[model samples]
Target: MEIFRNKKTFTDYIERQKEMGKRIGFAPTMGALHQGHLSLYEAAQKENDLVISSIFVNPTQFNNPDDLEKYPHDTNRDLKLLENTGIVNAVYLPEVADLYPAGLKSKAYNFDGLENEMEGKSRPGHFDGVGTVVEELLRQVKPDNAYFGEKDFQQLAIIEKLVQQLKLPVKIHGVEIYREDNGLAMSSRNERLNAVQRDAGKVIHETLVKVNDWFRIITIAEINKRVKDIFDDQRGMTLEYFEIADEQTLKQTDFFYKDKNYRAFIVVNVGEVRLIDNMHLD
Candidate 1:
């Protein structure tokens, strides 16, 4: 796949594609590619004539500077993997300046109620940074469709809402979360976990699995307690939040949800790496 690091070159390439009447599909990612990310690439290839993926580790999204500094990067390996995928047409490896030029004021994008809980509440301004960078990338690519993983379920919901609210010409599609054989959800952060931490991390997924019950309706606090109990059983792991909420609205539920659609999610710290996982409450 062709690689363009500068904005002008990437835009020109897109211009040529537009002239050829090719439908564009884009996947935005911070480097450290994995099977979960490649799955999005596969979905994009299936539905669009041209597929573009961006590999920039966005700085503004991190509330913790240390987390930003420690985030994984290996562009050479990532490029090789993308090339092998046979699905990515071009990879946009833009510098931070290319996306955010000097003296360009920061733009604010928030989902009101949805932005204040779970990951957002824990890491303030996290989604604003996510929205800012995603808006910039979506505007730059101007794709007919964009693919995101359900692993970042809340972020996917937020992006969908942004596209609808702004009338962007892109359709957002979500790929299901890819998991390891032992059930730990695949994530770039998984690379940072030590052996014990990685083993303990499975508890996050298992807690959700054990707690999910009664598709019709069940008390949210009861489910929340069930998840917290599982986390409590695992030492050295701190529970950040356990929630069951409307998938689209993301508002936490206390009473039983009569509506059949929602999600069970958790964010817990296994050592310094914060892992988030969710299972659809069917």
Candidate 2:
């Protein structure tokens, strides 16, 4: 697979591919490659003539400096994993300087009401950073299609909005979340968890599953109480927020609307790693 660290070379290569009438599919990632990331590459491979994946741990997205510093990285291993997939045609590995040659600039994005809840409220400037980097990458690659996992369901919604607002000629596709055998959602942060913490993390998924099963029969307040009770009972897991929200707008709903689809979103701190997961509650 071809590796590019410079933006001009990467853009030139992409342009050449476009000239050849190739339909390019892109997967933008923050490295720490795992089965979850490879799944995105697999999905992209099926639909496009050529696939490109980028690994740039964007600093702009992190509201906490310590969280950014502690974020995982292993370039050699990431490339090996991508090579093993044999689906990625090229890999874009850019330094912070490469992405922000002019240095960082503050930016803002309006996601309608989607950005006002959950992660946005928790992380402050997180979605703005996400919007900035994703917009830049989409511009640089200019692919026909871009793939993102539904694991970050809210972020996926924001990206869809970003594409619409910017009038970019790319289609955004959200793949289903990849999970571990025990039902915990696969995440790069899972690397930081010890065996005990890893097992404890399963409670997050279990709680979501319980909510999914009972959401139809119970009131939203009872659902919230049940979820809190589960977290309180767990030794190592600390619940951040659990909400039943309209899937489209991501605004918390007090009652399940018969006309709208809903989802349960959860965040938990297992040891030092913060994990997020969502389940569709139909």
Candidate 3:
């Protein structure tokens, strides 16, 4: 895989590819590469002539300093993983200066109230950071297609809104969430969880599955209470927020509407590591 640590060279390469009539696909990540990330690459490769990616753990997205400090980082392993796929033609490994040349700040965006949803409500200024780095990367790459994992369903919605507000000519694709054999959503943060905590994390997916089964059969209120009770019983897991919301707008709904599709979003604090997962409440 071609590696780029500089902006101008990266853009020049992308321009050359575009001039050759290549359709580019892009996926921006925070570097601790996993199968979930590669899955996006595979999806991109199927439709685009070339696929590119960026790996920069953006600092502005983190509300907790410790979370930032504790984020998983493994450059060698990440690079190796990307290389193994042979689908990624280039990967941008930018320093803070390379991405944020203007002294590190997120551009102000009102993702049309998408900025105030679940993850947004839980962590302040999170989407601003997400929007900033994403906008920066998308501008530089200018790909025809972009891919994101559905594991962060809310963030995916926010990014779709960001792309719209910016009026960028790119299609955003949300690939299905990748999971461990036990159904826990795959994440870099999973690296921090001990074996015990990892096993405990299974409860998250289990609960999501139960909610899926209970979705329209029971009242929303009872389902909410049942979800809470399940997590409340787990020893090391803390239920952060669980919402069954409109599938498209991401607006949390108290009751399932007859005309709208719904999805269940949940965040669980497993010990110190925060885990997020969502299931379509079909």
Candidate 4:
């Protein structure tokens, strides 16, 4: 696959491909390629004539400087994984300056209160950073369709809103959450966990499974308390937040509406490694 480091070169190439009438698919990510990320590529490839992706551990999206510093990066392995995909037509590796240019600053956005719940409430300015870098990537790539993982359900919702608010002409597709044998969601950050922590990580998904099972018979308030109680007793982990929210607005709700779509969102801090996952609660 062709690799373009220069922003204009990649943009020009995409433009040329568009002129040739090839439908473009994009999967933008930080450079820690895994099966979960590749799943997005597979999803894009099935629908588009060409598939492209970018590797930029966006500094803007990181609220904690330590997190910005600690976020994983293995360009060689990442590229090799992309190469192995065989379906990836091209790769874009943009420098911080290429995307940011001015400095490591994030542009502010109003996600219409969508940014004020769950992950947004925990990480200040996180969605703004997400909005800034994603807007830049979407504009530069300008693909007919962009793919995201449902693991980051909140982020996906915010990005869909971003596309609408910015009036970007691209469809957003959300792939299902990919997990490990232990049922822990696959993530680059998982590399940070040791064996025991990895075992402990299973609890996050385990709890979600219970949440899904209990949604039909239990009260939302009771489920919320039960989730909290599980993590409260879980060893070597902290439950950052477990929210049963409306699938669309993402607002945490104690009352489940009969006709509304609902999803369970969760975040857990395993030692220093933070992990997140979500499930469709029917």
- TM-score for candidate 4, please give it: 0.97
**Local distance difference test, per candidate?**
0.85, 0.90, 0.91, 0.91
RMSD of 3: 1.0
For TM-score, candidate 1 versus 4, the one ahead is 4
Q: Each candidate's TM vs. the true structure?
A: 0.95, 0.98, 0.98, 0.97
Candidate 2 per-residue C-alpha lDDT over 107-144 given as tens digits, one digit per residue, 9 for 90 to 100: 77778978889998978888888988898889999999
Could you give me the TM-score of model 3 versus the true structure? Answer: 0.98
Estimate candidate 1's alpha-carbon lDDT, on a 0 to 1 scale: 0.85
- Give the per-residue Cα lDDT of candidate 1 at 278: 90
Model 4, range 15-107, lDDT digits (tens) per residue? 899899999999999988899999999999999999999998877678788998888778999999899989899999998888787898999
Q: How does model 4 fare in lDDT?
A: 0.91
Q: Distance from true position, residue 74, model 1, in Å? A: 1.0
Q: Each model's RMSD to truth, in Å? A: 1.6, 1.0, 1.0, 1.1
lDDT of 3 by residue, 1-282 (tens): 799998889989988998999999999999999999999999999999999989999999999999898888889899999999989999998889877899788778898888888888878899999998998899999999999999988889899988887799999999999999899999999998999999878889998999989988999899999999998888988888888999788898888778999999998999888889999877
1 against 4, candidate with superior lDDT? 4
Candidate 3 achieves a global lDDT of: 0.91
Answer with 1 or 2, whichever has the higher lDDT. Answer: 2
Q: Which stretches of candidate 4 lie over 4 Å from their true place?
A: none
